[model samples]
Target: MHTFSRADFERFGQLYDIEFRFPAIHGDNSTDDYIVARGEITEHSLASGFRFTFSSLEVLEAYDSVSCGHAPLLVLVVLDGIVRLTLGSVEHELTPGTAVSMQLHPDYPLQAHQPEQQHLEIMALAFDPRRAKLGHVSPSLHGLTILPRMPLRQWKVPHALQQLLRTYAGLTMTGTQKNLVLEGVALQLAGLGLGSEEQESPDVPVVPVQQRQRLELVRQHLEFTPDHDHSLKDLAQMAAMSPSGLRAKFRAMYGVPVFDYLRKCRLQLAKHYLEQGFSVEQCANKVGYTHATNFSTAFRREFGFSPRQRTVDQKK
Candidate 1:
């Protein structure tokens, strides 16, 4: 078994030009071990934001369980596929559009994949709450209060949070433009996670006549670019409103959050592919899942049957 600490992770970068660093653990491995798998770990430390990471992994073998962390403090955003982890006897999962924070613990159990070449894509930020700058977030961002006692807790990562992660995860900008986008999104996440939560509201506002058109544009963009990573704040900016305003208006207009709408689009597209004789892997990639299992799981959940079953019916 190959045990990895900070230095070993860094070597994956230095030795192979991978963006990696530590506080992570991957059991035993050798250079040749990567032949059956392909992945990347990108870790960056923002001058103004917290330390964060983006990982996309595809594993063909699942004999030895791979795990990471029990970190000092961390926030996680799972974009695709199932995240597997165990704490003592309890197991936890982070699906798409969910956020979570974990504190110091001995071992928090983990794995990057399942059998059948399942892929996982995740973005995580490591932080110290006492010191992170939360910017101008509302006081009601406390959906993350699990336990100072050492366990995992779920947080409904808002649309803005999803946008922030997506914007950064799929960014192609550079220099000042890149930094501005990163800093802006990072601050949003900090505020969303660490900000003092506001009380829930039963009554919501109606969208203005002018704002309705803009929200339509946002929806259209998501529909067309179902695979593009979108940031809620940026989309709101495009819609000429505050992020909150855009969210309210969009729900009023479409009755679903931005990504939820996108998911429906992706699933529909996957169905078309399945009927047109595309393989599950091809359909998964076409629809933005890094792994086939994740795609199948999502497809089954959305359509109530496995993609394989769909394929069989298509043949029949």
Candidate 2:
């Protein structure tokens, strides 16, 4: 296993952004944004032409948008925490137990939101679609189209598959045995994540390009400044739509109600604060909650544990 800390990951990001361009250019080309403030990412690459990464890290800061490099195809499984991403014009949220199989285009790179303070554990498998010969392994990916706005598939990860990944991560093996095991895992992940040949893309409502761009502004506001007490009228004005139109279209496009998304962003940041040794009341106020009780209730509902409990657990 190859382990990379934040500094190492940042250096590689810089290199990939600035110098590397053999097979393809990867990593977001940014100067100021630090990817992670804590934790590490471990990777295992197989000779069978697949690379798998297990990343456990905390976001250094909140970003409304960050570009991800070109990959022909990628299967991402959210082991824990939430990841928000935009492909083409559609925004998606990946929670624990969820996985996505996406066919990415070079021109329209994937845009991501890294939530501040939130700890994330993500497992990603990436490969070149042209050379992967996935048809022989899984017939479903045979005719997968490579589009700028491709039809990606989202599904729940099986419990057994999750256990298998954890098991593989713990195993001590090398050489041919490791390669064989990795090949099998790769196939299984791809088969389950993107296995349905008949899986149809969800019907995303077609809004005008101008309206979509404005809607994105609203989303960015909610994501980046979740602590603000945003009003629907103001947000509607920002999106150049009626309040109801904004409400309906935002949900239609982003898969969640507008304010509901904001609540999630706030709670995610609050959780991060609690992990960093902040008091429950402090976290509640910081995330715009007037009452600590309300914040505690919401936090427990969202994360299945109280803020104080999170702090205690971390100490242990």
lDDT value, candidate 1, whole model: 0.60
* Each prediction's TM-score versus the true structure: 0.42, 0.50
Worst 10 residues of 2 by lDDT: 17-26
Residue ranges of candidate 1 with Cα displaced over 4 Å: 1-36, 63-72, 106-116, 128-150, 167-169, 194-316
Q: Rate the local accuracy (lDDT) of all candidates.
A: 0.60, 0.69
What is the C-alpha lDDT profile of model 1 across 81-132, one tens digit per residue?
6665533323455677777665533233433223334666678775443334
Model 2's alpha-carbon lDDT is 0.69
Which segments of model 2 are wrong by more than 4 Å? 1-9, 14-35, 63-68, 129-149, 199-316
Clashes of 2: 0
